[model samples]
Target: MAKELDLIEEFRDLSLVCEVTPRSVKLGMLKLTNSFLEKVKECQKRDRKLSEKLVLIDEGKEDDF
Candidate 1:
């Protein structure tokens, strides 16, 4: 799961490497940027949930899941 999150982060960084010029290019870059950021947000949310579950498990609260 950590690895998956890392890959998503890398993709988010990659999406930031565009060079916008014309209007169309700018629009496309905006689309790509938004897409990558949404993906990052989703991954981060999942990671947070997993970490919270791990903490619960450590405290012997596995029934909460």
Candidate 2:
């Protein structure tokens, strides 16, 4: 839960790659980087179905409020 990305931190890293997620993805984490994480993050921000469940949970919070 605490691992979720905040909007400010999310947008701050508009160019995050897969390696950047080692802390989150863990051992067998599929390597995503550059446009991959960028697009995925974008989708995670805008599109529901395309985003990961964790990202979805983060995006769903009203912390910005």
Cα deviation of 39, candidate 1, in Å:
14
Lowest lDDT 10-residue stretch of candidate 2: 18-27
Report the error of model 1 at residue 3, Å. 40
lDDT of 1 by residue, 1-65 (tens): 67755655665676654433434222124442488888987887779778798789999979666
- Please report the candidate that would top lDDT against the real structure: 1
RMSD in Å for candidate 2, one decimal? Answer: 19.2
Query: Candidate 1: where are CA atoms >4 Å away?
Result: 1-46, 63-65
| Candidate 1 accuracy as lDDT | 0.63
Candidate 2, residues 1-65, lDDT tens digits: the string is 44454643564455433232635532233355598878877776876554455565688853332
What is each predicted model's overall lDDT from 0 to 1? Answer: 0.63, 0.52
